[model samples]
Target: MRRKHTLAATAVAGILTVALGTSAAQAEVAADCGPGGPGEFANHTLLVFPGSHQPIYDFVNSAKRSIDLTMYELDDTTMEADLIAAVQRGVDVRVILDGRVGPGSKYYQPGYDKLKAGGVNVVWSNPAYYFTHQKTLTVDDRESLVMTGNLDSYYYNSDRDYALFDANPLDVRAIGQTFDADFADQAVTPSAGSGDLVWSPTTSEDRILDVINGAHRTLLVEQEEMYDTDVINALIAAAQRGVQVKLAIIEECDLYPYLNQLLAAGVQISLNNTSTDTLYSHAKVFVADYGQWDERAEVGSINISNTSLNENRELGVILDAFGPRNQQVLDTLDSVITGDFNDGQTYVATTDPSCG
Candidate 1:
């Protein structure tokens, strides 16, 4: 039995329930999933991409004391102006820009230079790490905005992605420490299986595998890239144990090999190809034992790759069945897997073809 926590009625009213199998009204976690009350899940705002920039800007605009942000990309001038305005208003704003070579590098000089010139304390990420791919914005060391996508306009306005705003003390403190370590270019050991926020290079892989293996009934996943062998093996092991596993990813040629393996193991795989459809998936999330009494969900910038898991700086949150955010994640998964948006191609196990 899960431990129960008491939450205000207003907080309980904010829960996002998973509506599936029937076009019925929104369900509450207290009535649907676990023994715990709505307080079991942290109160957080879920931001779906495509014109979700305003909420992000609004969060940044609300910073009162300080703002510490680390992003893989920043091409949007709207966010830039907000940062500048925050600095001008006597807020201590610090930014860590990715120095590694990539698309964001193109905007470093143009998008970020003006802020540095205007007195914002901006610096490039440590050269030792693969990439600072974590997208986080901490305000007043109390609230945090974690994301599965970049801060670029194209990602917020055009790409399929999501963001999470959390005020959980444990999550806020853990994420703040990680950012401080990265900004100082000092080695930092991330917390192992913290309450909500899970960090890479320490806890992400093992914790994520736990979620995948914990699923006694269902596992739903949506990721941008999938090449991590350990995660693949975990999913295969789960399916062999009779767990219903489903994957919906934006089809990339490199993922075909891994998708084939999962399909061979009875894991349902769907690849969204633009050649035939318009829905492209960019959200990185995992739902364990979905809709079950002990459903667990994770969403963040962490990707299933060796670099993302071990080399790059990444963050994600774990939401239990006690809240609406997890249900919202399930809602998104339902839409993709049920073909509500795009008609995805389902892959089946087949013999390896010869190049000759």
Candidate 2:
């Protein structure tokens, strides 16, 4: 039996029940999926991109004591100015920017130079890992913002992304601890942070698969890449077992093979085009059994690729519907995902030899 935690009546009110057929064996498997017990009982706020920049700016602007940030890419001059302003206000600011080089990698030297010149304590990320893909900011050791998008101004208007403001003491402390280690280029293991944080190169694969396998009715996913075989197999298994699995991904020819396999397994797939006029699918998010008792959502910078999951420094959070505010976050996520899926074109497989 799964342990039950008491939730406030306000939190439980209006939670709709969902019914889906599951065999006894599958039910047992779902029951064993951990992270299903009580809620974190922390305050959280969700932010959707291509909507407003105020919330993020507000978080940074309000920091009076200290600011610790880790970013994969930093190209927004406005944000750079904000960090410098914070430093000028006598706030201790530290930043770690990814310095890895590769195709499609954004150059960070200009931003690094600008931040250094402006009196911000900024350093390049540790090169031991393939990349430091974590997009997180901790303010005064009190609140943390975990994000799926970069600070690049070029994608601010077109990228579909999400950020969560977590004010939980445990979550904030854990994030700060990891940032301290990462900023100094030292080895460290990230704390579970109220048992909600998901860190890559460690527990991300197992934790993510647990969420997929634990779903009894539906699973909604949005990702920028979909090349990880374990993730592909997990989604296929969930759909095979009567879970309604839907995925929205950026349209790319290299992903056709994976898309065809998912289509063959009855998983509905939608493709978002890379046009500036449309929302690009760059978010890494998952929603499972929304509106149900075990409803949960995850948002972070972890991508569905071997290097991202196994060798990169990444971070994410699993949010359970435990409080009224948390439920609101999940509700907003579900609505946005539904809209994106509906607005995207249904993918159709092509056998063109040039696709290879």
Candidate 3:
């Protein structure tokens, strides 16, 4: 069902309520209105995984009116129960689960059936795209949560993931518009929403390349897959131009060739193996020119692959260091990624069978 009031109206009301009661430390970060800058730096609450479950849970439990969720995978019972409880409390709840996992895959069916039986309005995602890889949740059209990880219980403690809480009205409205269209199985070209959001099958590739090319000093990246030639070339060009590029990635045999190319281009690489590392590198993050005035970080479900960039329904945001809270977010990201890169083993193609 469509919302009774317009998204803008609802957002305005919700924002006022939240602002009146929220503490200064927890206040919503507003977009920088200063002159001579792109309006990409907006309000956001950053959450890093393995320890972000409580914050996410609190966000859901605090919902009083409505909930709109789009997930690529959902097997976390805690979240499932929370959604069901939200529905029971008379809150309007709608969910879109990715349908492209194929017929025999048991990743999402149990949660799907459970949500339906629990009185939540849920449906399979639109199959027009290759996959609905977006992991986002919109609460009361006032706040949007964009995530890089699925809510799968097993990976809750083992994967390195990140999520952003966005309270920008434009972002919330854009997310709501896309949800409404996708809920009914209609086509949509998601809005950039304050020019901060990056959507796949439309502008993800270009936006990511822009981040890569625009970085003048340093680039810290963490990604699960790295097969896109354009992305690889951009990283190589950045490295060739003396940009310090450091990549943290999980070791995948199929990606050896690409890794070799990056290594040959003077890009430092750190490989994480599940057999040896405690945290799997499943995060899609790019911290460009961190700590500088032009510092910005990209975080979401968009992987560095052609399929994820040009085929899947992915969502990401480029967060700039505009406000104190936003700067804190970047600071945390820099610390975590630097540690991951330092702890990982350096990739040597000569020792790998695939590279041979």
Best by lDDT: 3
lDDT of 3 at 322: 83
User: Candidate 3, TM-score vs. the true structure?
Assistant: 0.86
Q: Which ranges in model 1 have alpha carbons more than 4 Å from their true place?
A: 1-42, 102-104, 192-194, 323-342, 348-356
Give the true-structure RMSD of model 3.
9.4
Q: TM-score per candidate, in order?
A: 0.82, 0.86, 0.86
In model 2, what is the error at residue 190, expressed in angstroms?
A: 0.9
Off by over 4 Å in 2: 1-42, 102-107, 274-277
For residue 307, give model 2's deviation from the true position in Å. 0.9
Evaluation by lDDT, superior candidate among 2 and 3: 3
Off by over 4 Å in 3: 1-42, 102-104, 354-356
In candidate 2, what are the lDDT values of residues 178-247, reduced to their tens digit?
A: 8988888899989988899999888899889989999999999998888889999999999999999999
The alpha-carbon deviation from the true structure for residue 154 of candidate 1, after best TM-score superposition, in angstroms, is: 2.3
**Of candidates 2 and 1, the better by lDDT:** 2
Clashing pairs in 2: none
* 10-69 per-residue lDDT for model 1 (tens digits): 010122223223211322321221331222224565655544355567667767788999
lDDT of each: 0.70, 0.78, 0.79
Q: In every candidate, how many clashes are there? A: 1, 0, 0
